[model samples]
Target chain A: MSSNKQNEIALAAVKLFEQKGYRATSVQDIADAVGLQKGSLYHYIASKEDLLMQIAHQAILQFNEQLEEILAKEDTARGKLEQMIRTHLIMSIDNLETTTVLWREAFSLGEGPQEVIQGMTDKYLNLVADILRSGTETGEFNVTHPRITALAILGACNWVYRWYHPSGTLTAEEIADIFSKLFLDGLLAH
Target chain B: MSSNKQNEIALAAVKLFEQKGYRATSVQDIADAVGLQKGSLYHYIASKEDLLMQIAHQAILQFNEQLEEILAKEDTARGKLEQMIRTHLIMSIDNLETTTVLWREAFSLGEGPQEVIQGMTDKYLNLVADILRSGTETGEFNVTHPRITALAILGACNWVYRWYHPSGTLTAEEIADIFSKLFLDGLLAH
Candidate 1:
């Protein structure tokens, strides 16, 4: 199979596995979706697990790159937080399939894959934690526990995959701004 | 079937469903887990959908009761927020299986049951939103958009069901207090 054809098959397999689920999806189903024989499809990937690994790797790499870019921006902790929120929303919208798969199946990656994914997740968490820590040090915020705060904020941001609609009323920028203001100043007026 | 027996069956079904899934789980599996014959299980529930509905309803009722009790306490918005946070953590831990099912299969509830569950969900959201609104009105809060802020805060709380384990390092009270402080006061130190 041509390299382009291989990528197409892998993409179709990822979408099917992510949506219909891994156990429910078969190689033949993937082959049928991509208009190839099951036998010919094996020319591209070795197994269903390989397809999952490839998709998961790509998703994590994208998330890491986005995180790095957001952190690299020459901005204050608040600005970085806002940028992180916006970029996460945009990526989730643009990469809904992989994001859904990541959220749903990260636990199924077995020990090795779980560790890799956990490492990525921890790295992501630490990135947000660093911002919160910096915010606390700068006297611009007053949080009691920076680590837990980071976890809560990241949890809120990562969960957009569960409910976000591409054509929904709230834009990415709007959500980022709303989240930033809510977390920074809180609801109670002093 | 006796009412107790029916509930016994339903509880077993929740365990099986959470460990496996709704589609992958069979009525026979549930019956076997409860030590009842497959054919005899119908004496308690009509179908798997019925089992799901019962379990979800029970979980929602438990959550609603907790919220009501918290709101009834003679306290300010800050105290109420702490109550909400603590109760939420305790409920999630005490009813992990039901909470998992609630988070996982919520979108799959049929129309009649879906409406009921959605109503419960809306009530829960409004409960939190009302607290924030009250805080703002009393000059104890600074939230600009109550609806969006409520959703973000609720999102933070709800996502904990996916990753938290009660037996882990943090106790329920500790988690709740940390959540309340982080969300209410934020991460920046003044």
Candidate 2:
């Protein structure tokens, strides 16, 4: 199988899955999008679920790679948190279709793939929590519950996908700055 | 048509919709859940989409009513914001199944009902933004871009449905308090 053809098929799948939903989108629709016959499409992938898992896995890998780079930085926890939010926003907006499909369709996968995605999500949550815990210990942050706080911060960041658009007034960087300020300094005037 | 039976049918639909995606669930499945014949189920709802609209409408109505009560109070913006978070948390957790269905499946409705839910959602976002704007004007809150801030705050709150559980260590009120504090005060040590 040509890797180029596989990549093209994967991209087409994400587009259809995001717009029509994973269940509503059919394998033939994806094949049509990529200018391939339904039978020929199988040359690159086993089934629709296989294509979905590939896209979902790729999304998570990209997220984890970016997060790992941010974690490797020797900045303070606050700084690293800001970087995490910035990276998340940039990636989410840039890959909006893929992100949408991953969030919306990953659960529809079989148990093994679902568990794989869920496990990656758990690790992502824990890494955020670890940052909060370190900040608290270093007296840089005053969080009472690191895990819950992490969830709130990430939730705020993730929800950007529902509204962010390329033509929107605020760029990803601007939104990231706003979120970082909101999380780090809060709404209080003090 | 018996309102009691209608209510039972609606409740069962919410449960099934939450467990199974709206597309995958059949009218027959909903009827089976409520011990009603498929033909009889049509007596209560015009179609599966109609049932979804009813549930989604009720969810938005409950949210709006709670928010109105909170807004009617003459509390300070800080106090009201805290109350808003608390009210949202409690209501969301209490109606977990309904909320799950609303968030996940409401968009699958036909354009008309989808518009209705979207309109209500826009109004809700505007109301939250209004509070932030007033708070900023009153010099009680230091928010910049109230609309964006509102989205972030609500996003954090709404994402609670993804992870929250009755068996979790923290109750809804405790989680609400934590979120309120996080939103109102910076994570950085004062």
Best by TM-score: 2
Tens-digit lDDT track of model 2 for B1-190 = 9999999999999988887778888999998998889998998899999999999999988888889999998999999899899999898989999988887678688889999998998898889999999999999999889988999998898878777888999999999999998998979998
**DockQ, prediction 1:** 0.53
Cα lDDT tens digits for candidate 1, B82-156 = 788888878886788888888766545678997898789779878988988898888888877676677787778
After the best TM-score superposition of candidate 1, give how far the Cα of residue B23 lies from its true spot, in angstroms.
3.3
Which candidate has the top score in DockQ?
2
For A14-119, candidate 2 gives per-residue lDDT tens digits of: 9898887788889999999999999999988999999999999999889888999999989999998999999998999899999888776776799999899889
Go through the candidates in order and give each one's C-alpha lDDT: 0.79, 0.89
* lDDT agreement of model 1 with the native: 0.79
lDDT of 1 by residue, A122-142 (tens): 788888888878876886666
Worst 10 residues of 2 chain B by lDDT: B99-108
Those runs of model 1 whose alpha carbons end farther than 4 Å from true positions after fitting are A10-29, A108-111, A137-141, B72-75, B108-112
Clash list (residue pairs), candidate 2: none
